[model samples]
Target: MSASHYHICSRNIGKPVEIRTRDGRVHRGIIHRVDNRMVYLRPLPQRNYGGYGYGWGWWCGFGWGVALGAIVGLALLPWFFW
Candidate 1:
């Protein structure tokens, strides 16, 4: 696992982030938690309606677990982009 990715993820808890993994897939979600081997993400609700923001979308109770070792790139999303 990349040490920088771990530190960045840990420091940015509760913030929205987009992560690109080594396998070429991208994951977008809020940083829920971080650990030695993985980072848990609270998935952003998919917007099915006409507006934007957190309030309008389907919400899942569980968060996603991504291995820090698989991450190739990660960035914090600005409020206007969410």
Candidate 2:
């Protein structure tokens, strides 16, 4: 499938997604949102918090709800910060 075919598309709004970071790690979560170059995921309970790929992005796995929200919000509006 093409990159745009990821589960984060509009039709799969509430579906689950699997993310493989650049470091060979994996995460599974709800497809919160997807932008041109990044995928925002609210990682599943079992696969939350672990090694992350090196890149400009946000990640949340366990109890850091507030931090997670902040990152996702920023990613959604990258123009403001970029």
Model 2 misplaced stretches (Cα beyond 4 Å) = 5-10, 45-82
Put down candidate 2 lDDT per residue, 1-82, tens digits, no spaces.
3243433244564455444443455555555666555455564334335586454445555311111212221112222222
lDDT by residue (tens digit), candidate 1, 1-82:
4799999999999899999999999999989889999989998756556655665555567888889989999999985685
Model 2 worst lDDT run, 10 consecutive residues: 64-73
Counted clashes in each candidate structure: 0, 0
lDDT of all predictions: 0.86, 0.41
Q: Which pairs clash (backbone N, Cα, C closer than 3 Å) in model 1? A: none
Off by over 4 Å in 1: 46-60
